[model samples]
Target: MPKGYEMLPNGIIRIKSDNSMYDPWEIKKSQLDGEELTLIGRVVWAEQKM
Candidate 1:
């Protein structure tokens, strides 16, 4: 885990390209095209915690 990233719970990731869905190929914290997506099931972080 990074300094500002946490694990996701029951989350689903989706890969996108040009603002479009890539396909059924989703993933976890990773880097694509030299970019660190830092995704946990497509979730960067918990935007809202209620």
Candidate 2:
């Protein structure tokens, strides 16, 4: 993560469990390389709150 990098539109980020855990909302920037494009996690359905 850097200071002024923008997140890719419709782009999903997957970080390894070995990496540090962070809230998705807290990720304002990222430093992704082409080799690190592999997905480390999958997103399922989100629960609806009433």
Candidate 3:
């Protein structure tokens, strides 16, 4: 998660997505527990590729 972001008790993490019409969506951290996900870097900014 980003700085100052809090993890929901339900384990749902909301992230911003410029590509999605939904914008913010819930993604349960529990769902990735078995996947062993890793954080490589933080995105400071982004631009749409068209």
State which candidate has the highest TM-score.
Answer: 3
Per-residue lDDT of model 3, residues 1-50, tens digit only: 24223367887776554444435556688888778544344676867989
Q: Give me the displacement of residue 7 in model 2, in angstroms.
A: 29
- How does residue 15 of candidate 1 score in lDDT? 44
lDDT of 3 at 20: 47
Per-residue CA lDDT of model 1 for 1-50, tens digit only, reads 22223345544345444323343355454434445554344435555678
**Alpha-carbon RMSD, each predicted model:** 11.7, 10.6, 7.1
Which candidate do you rate higher for TM-score, 1 or 3?
Answer: 3
User: What TM-score does prediction 3 earn?
Assistant: 0.39
The digit string of per-residue lDDT tens for model 2 on 1-50 reads 21122345556442334324543332312444444443344544456789
Off by over 4 Å in 3: 1-6, 17-22, 34-50
Candidate 2 Cα deviation (angstroms), residue 6: 30
Estimate the lDDT of model 1: 0.42
Clashing pairs in 3: none
